[model samples]
Target: MKLYTWLSAPNPRRALIFVAEKAIDIDIEEASDPDNPGQLSKRYCEKYPHRRVPLLELDDGDWIAEAAAVCKYLEALYPDNPLFGRNAKEAALIEMWDRLAEWEGLMAVSEVFRNTHRLFVGRGLAGYDIQIPQISELAERGKLRLGRFFNKIDERLDQNEYLAGDIFSFADITALCAIDFSLSRKLIIPENCCNVKRWYQAVSERPSAIG
Candidate 1:
């Protein structure tokens, strides 16, 4: 199997972290930057029409595009270090928290960065052809929503060691990537969020986090 990914991208980082946690070895291919029209080679465009990174190509020639789906596929293949969940109820809870982290946390941070950053002036959303104009009002709203999301995560971590519970599952990985991505936009985790800070420190020290 071969994984197509970009080292600096948040989505690919999530997949890399998952692969690291599982201690699996897979060939990796870095995708060229789509931002540079000259560098957007025809071969890459034909292989990945959506122009998204962190895509997993199976040995049988099947391709998995989304980050969550790629992680799920890895989990299913390597059940020894199960990150999704062990049972039905645990799976549901993990999925719920994962979705919350992606929609509330990751999407919020992306909204602010993409809309306000000059690099994305003509291309705000990902995996789509339509170009959306920057909206300062939406950027402000995104910042506010991100603050609330951080507070919610801090509150959750205050009671539990991890997002779903005691175990460090895929939800924690999702939150970790999202929180780290916010730092690039100068959205530091508040000092008052001690629980979140503590949790982050622990997760950051893990070997998989380095991936």
Candidate 2:
């Protein structure tokens, strides 16, 4: 199996970090567009129509596109570390928190970046080559939503060590990547969110986080 990734991207980083935490051995390919540098390569786009990063190409010629799905595939194959949780209840909790982190935090951060960054001026949305105009109002709204997300997570973190509970699961990984990605937009944990700051410090110190 092979994993195609763009290390600079936050979504791909989540998968990469999960792999590191699990200590899985797999062929890893760094993806890049020869013509556009940071964009997906033309040949890669042709091979994978969806054109998503952190893609997992199976030995059976099957492919998993989403980053979380990629991690799930890997976890099923290598279940030693058990990032998805060890039981049914744990799995549901992890999945629920992971979805919250992805939609509320990561998507919000991407919303601001896609609509405000010059690199995405004409391509505000991903997975398409067509011109999709950026809306400045969306960026402002994203910032507001992200702020609310941070506050909500802060309250949750106050009672537990990790996003889903006491265990450092995939939800923590997604939330970590989201918070780091938000830094590019000058968005950060509010000073009043002491619990979030504490959680960030602990998670960022992990060896997997460096990957």
Candidate 3:
């Protein structure tokens, strides 16, 4: 299998971390420059109409897009590590937290970064041909949303070691990527969120967190 990804991007980082945690062996192909969308190759764009990174091409020539979907495909292929969950209830809980991290954390940070950053002026939204103009108001709203997300994360970590529960799962990966991405965009985690800080430190020490 060939995994096409941008090493620095959060979504691709999630898939990369999943592969690292599972010790999966696959060919990795860097697809495009995240800062410059025009660098994406025509061949890759043909294979993935959405023109997004973290695309997986199976040996049999089947293509899979979307970071979470790629992770799910790998999980099904190699179940021993079992990052998703063991049972139905656990799976549901993990899924809930994972979605929260992606929507509340990752998406919020992305809204601020893409809208405000000069490099992404007309490309606020990913995987679309239409280029939306930057909205300062939306960037402010995104920052507010991300701040609340950090507080909520701290509260959850205060009760559980991991986002979903005691065990490390996919939710942790999503959160880690979100936190790191936010930090890169100059959104620092509040000092008052001690639980979140501790959790971040612990997760950062893991081998999978390394690029």
Candidate 4:
């Protein structure tokens, strides 16, 4: 198996965290994509039609795209670690919160970072090129939504060590990547989220967080 990875991107970081937690070893190929050639290239698109980073090219010539799907495949292949959960119902709960974090939390951050950050003008996954300055109003609008989700997550964390289940799961990994990515954009946890702060500290202390 081979992983197409990007160190600075949250989506690929999600898979990296999972591989670390599960202790799975797979060959990694860094796809720079600076010239937009990586995505538009016929070679990569033949196996991965979408041509996104974080794609897994299996030895059998099957292509698995998307961060969540790649992680899910890894979890299934390595069942002892059980990041997704032990059973269907337990897995569903983790999936519920994980999806929420990905959509409401990570997506909003990506919108701001991709459109507003000058560094991503042509280097982004969408293969977009050109200078696009930060739109304070647009970014703040997304920030408000992210703020609400963060508060809700903080409240939930106050009641449990993990987000969806008793054990560390996918939701924890996804949320952690999102929080860590905030360092690039200077997004900090608000002062009033005591519970969230506590949870973040705990996650920071984990050995896998050394990345």
Off by over 4 Å in 4: 34-47, 122-137
Candidate 2 C-alpha lDDT tens digits along 27-89: 999788766776888888898988778899999998999988999988989989899998999
Off by over 4 Å in 3: 33-38
Top candidate (TM-score):
2
Prediction 2 TM-score vs. true? 0.97
* Worst ten in a row by lDDT for model 4: 123-132
- List of clashing residue pairs for candidate 3: none
Q: State the displacement of the C-alpha of residue 65, model 4, in Å, after optimal TM-score superposition.
A: 0.7
Candidate with better TM-score, 1 vs 2 = 2
Model 1 agreement with the true structure over 64-128: per-residue lDDT tens digits: 98889998998888888888999998888899999999899888988898888877887677665
**What is the lDDT for 148 in model 3?**
95
Residues 1-211, candidate 4, lDDT per residue (tens digit)?
Answer: 9998864678888888788877887898776645653334445555565656688988998888888999998887888889898888989999998999888788778766765766655443353233345565656766786788789898898888888967888888888888777656888888888887888888777776666
lDDT of 3 by residue, 13-75 (tens): 999999999999999998874565545666677778888878999999989998888999999
Per-residue lDDT of 193 in model 4: 83
Identify the runs in model 2 with alpha carbons over 4 angstroms from their true place. Answer: none
lDDT of 4: 0.77
Q: Pick the candidate with the highest lDDT.
A: 2
TM-score (C-alpha) between model 3 and the true structure:
0.95
What order do you get sorting by lDDT, best first?
A: 2, 3, 1, 4
List pairs with backbone clashes in candidate 2: none
